[model samples]
Target chain A: MNSTIALFLLQDGVINGAIYALLGVTLVLIFAVTRVIFVPQGEFAAWGALTLASLESGATPGTALLLVVLGVSAAVVETIRERASMRPARLGVMAVRDVAMPIALLLIVSTIAPTKPALWLSVLLTLALVVPLGPLVYRLAFQPIADATVLTLFIAAIGVHFAMIGLGLIFFGAEGFRNEPFIAGVFPLGPLMFKGQSLVILAATAALLAALWFFFEHSMLGKALRATAINRLGARLVGIPTRATGRIAFALAAAIGALSGTLIGSLTTISYDSGFIISLKGFVAAIAAGLASYPVTVVAAIGVGVLESFAAFFASAYKEVIVFSLIIPLLIWRSLVTAHHDEEEE
Target chain B: MRQSIRIALLSGGVCLVGTTTLAQVNVGITVSQTGPAAALGIPQKNSVAQLPKEIAGQKVDYVVLDDATDPTKAVANARKMIAENKIDYLIGSSATPATMALVDVAAETKTPYCAMVPSKAVVDPVDEKRKWTFKAPQNDAIMAESLAEHMAANGVKSVAFLGFTDGYGQGWLEEVEKAMPAKGIKITAVERFQRTDTSVTGQVLKILASSPDAVLIAASGTVAVMPQKTIKEQGYNKPIYQTHGVGTMDFVRVGGKDVDGTVFPAGPVVVADLLPDSHPSKKVGLEYIKAYEANNKTPFAVFGAHLADCMSIAANSVKPALEKGKPGTAEFRSGLRDAIETTKELPATHGVYNYSPTDHAGLDNRSRVLIKIVNGKWTLLP
Candidate 1:
């Protein structure tokens, strides 16, 4: 390929890689904090994109209803599990956060959705609808099995993935959706045209990375999350509240996933099941980082994107095979480099 | 006591005859109701509710099952339906792999099978196993020929190909490879992408770099929009041609302005409203579309029409098949197969079927029409 074509491919790869990097970082974060593989992380992205599409089309997204349903279930599960320690104030907080909040959000969305609110409002509403779902999912699925083996948590995460996919189908139907890009122009740079949305995605990724760095390096809650990721029992001993930190990590992952979905929704057509494959690429990047280093995950995700783009160009039929096969060599190198550790006795 | 025993035997014999004449015809259906192919399967499942409840004065009981786009589950569903439901006819698994998986079971059970997918491999050559199988959708070869002819007539010399890596894509590619070469149209570039791929930019860039006169995308459903949109965004203004796999409105809806001028070969039913009254499929197509739209309260997808055509073909074959034997008998199954083979000029939504022992796809050039998306609407191309 010529320089111009190569440049175009690089630009395309970087844009996609940005999204994958965001997802990869979130996957790493969630896995580190919760000891769950978080397979349903992609589902939130799909839900975000679809919810935005529905709002644009002047219909209250079915995800609002789903949020209420999940919230109620999470509330019920949490209450029963903590019934012994539950106080009047805690019950009141649970009732408001889990039950009343979702109901109010549903009401607001249904009322404002028909008017086809502005893009920013729609996006904010989409996030509001999807972000809480992460914590709710943790409460309902993972928290119950918090002390279970990683294998069990991974299976539970897959179960949640299927459930979310099913719910996505019910909410979005089978039709795929694409949202209008936030910015609608192209910039020509040295014989290569960059789409406005691609730039937006790159900028957003950088900004999010900076925000995450600041959060972890400076913020108290972020330090607590880092501590939890380092040692759950130690963090609990230091009064960090491992459960709360886990929930916070999920919320952060959910937010990142939702934002990534919004960015991706403008770039391509997204269906209910689209997130799985996209997130799968991110998973590859995470695995390449040995599922630990965020900076390495970002770099690896970009590398994966570039590799995928080139692979598609060189061998279109084997694009997915080529991309997925990277994991094999990565695993080999990882095993060769890293020392294996036995599972810590619970 | 002897007279009473004689009377009881006589009544028993009459009751057996009564049940035999009024036996129900069980038709089992399996479709991908909740998986990747759900977009196609849901419509087919909906159309099942619109199928004829009674054919030739015999009650037709349809046992619908969800394969979830899994071929293994499709086989299991087929086996269960045959063993427990005692299905006389089987209509399957909305996708190619799942549909293909049911062929052996249909052959082994000596039952007639109807496949909703367009892959010619499902019924071509009509082997011992395939002879029992019939497909509803027009073969890829037929549509490919039409597409090649259109490209040639429009003075397109070279084309680029982009499609799914699945059977649908491979099937269309094989047909296009054959049809294009025969029309003296060269395929300059060939690319493949997965149905769930989020981006096809690299593939599109490569296709554009080849700079052919046209690009032909062989993907189906909403996924088809990705390559077209990516190509368009890259500023490739050449004519983009799609296959009948994208006949549904969802393709147009998802592709939007990028797909506006896209030329594709689709079933006549997709543009039934635009077809002249003289067209054989026009009346039936309109009728089916009306019934489906009224029931579903949405625009009728062309995929559903395939199942409707299958139902009509089966319904048309029932009368002659019933003349041979009872509904649940093997004689009836073979009779139905033979009758389906002899089907002639039977108009359905997609086309007029004329099946024969040598040809199980049962469609012709008349089954396909050239369509263009104009202003986000499907317009029949003259």
Candidate 2:
């Protein structure tokens, strides 16, 4: 009974699972609000981590906390601007206004936001950077590219993906970057549990999802966002600023991506290259449901993570094969189910 | 250029007066200089780049080509070096398959191909079937033999072997088979999988099912790190043995604390004390380590540095004969072959690389080390 091997696999699942899940959540949210899947989500993670790596080193706990506060503030502002603008808020005029700044800020902040920020501050800074991203994406990349064609939008995202990776390599250099874990050391629980910085990833993910659920379900802004997502014309007819709402969702989703990135940076040894893999996994997770939405995406990420964990334990070599092989059959099954459901409804 | 041609015409006329002119030997060096392989390529490139500088006194003209690590590309590149570049002796094709591709090209050109394949595929493919190709670098079979010795010294008996199904993995597997039996060890279990497969817990469970004294792992990159974590959590008390690929800090960091107590069989770390100052290899090994660290802007890697070392030693053997005025493909090949075999005076970073036509990998049992990963640090085993 090599419990350590089992524990290792179990812990890996939980840690990577949380990161994937949050990223999947952001992708889902953006898709939900805008009806377009965003592929640039991993850039937010890389950007957030790079931001933290720059600022999080050698700071006092108090200073770190202060950085986190400032980060949260930035995130709020970003969210408002992005989510509000997505409703085609100035009748397509402010489409430029809605998404441009957040994207620029994400790029700039991650690369040059200064180092030596406090540890807690590093994490906060990352979250703050991401908070507005979800909403921002809806306004900038999705909205403009949305009308062109699906292929164009997908291509645009792939281009963005390449651009982001190239930028990280050029700016960060092709080296694995480091960040000290916010907490160190592990507490083992019998044969099956782990307590360390990695476990904290799950806690953070839960908090993010809970926040999203609250905002989307209970808040006034949330209801407006849902209206905008359902039908821009109807929302506008009902006096909702659909354009503005879409922008805000873009900002919010972008922010979530950034926060996930930051959390990932805090927990793992990240290279600038880590983003693409994260992006790949996140993108796959988002589309886990044929249509990108939260219900299927989060489940997909968790499912993949669990599979990987089990693979790591039993056949680390075969884990990826298991993941890819599982997807093909799943897609077929999903198509069959969708067709059956459609027939039943008809 | 025209003016130099006139001078060369005059020199040729005078040289015609001098013993009907001496023969010329063409030499070629192959290394990876670009693409993903550039991680090891640049060093290989530099070794080729520096060969001419070292051959300043020799009469040999040389060519350098990039392997790029693709077997198809390597063959094309090697063929171009032979047919187009007019090189007589061929060295390198970074990976085993790449080297194997060059075997036919080398045979057609009648050029002797010497290579550095840490993977076992290079030698296993050559056997009685091919005689023109020789290996210069350490092979996985030899490495397995080394590892088997390590296991025996540590009082290990029953063991489980886990490896990827690729050439690198299978090569080590074959070598372990060769060496383990002599050590009186029984391989209780053997597990295999494709490199890209992410989960290995089932194979690990199967390996652990045998209740062996140790587990041998031969893998590289992400493939190397995943299993250590599984082994850690599954609570295996017996030491896990890894090949050279896992002997790096990447394994320790990626494996995290999960690999803290594992043992990986390796050769000398070019940066470390294994090559003492008194050893003839100290200066050359240290210099390459320094140059690679400076060029790559980092510390040393045992694998990359060893490749760099091979390039230097190969150049040393070929360069002088190339200069002795018999600078043709045949003379250069014969020269390199003779120099490599007869060169007992020079020292190699790995060991005294007295390579011969019969002994492609000129190594003995003394050429290895066992390193342990303990508390996230690489330490030599006691």
Off by over 4 Å in 1: A82-85, A344-346, B1-22
DockQ of 1: 0.65
Report the C-alpha lDDT of model 2 over A171-245, residue by residue, as the tens digit: 543334345666666676765545465666778788888888899899999998887766656888989976667
Clashes of 2: 88
DockQ of each: 0.65, 0.15
Clashes of 1: 0
Proportion of native contacts present in model 2: 0.18
Candidate No. with top lDDT: 1
Per-model TM against the reference: 0.96, 0.72
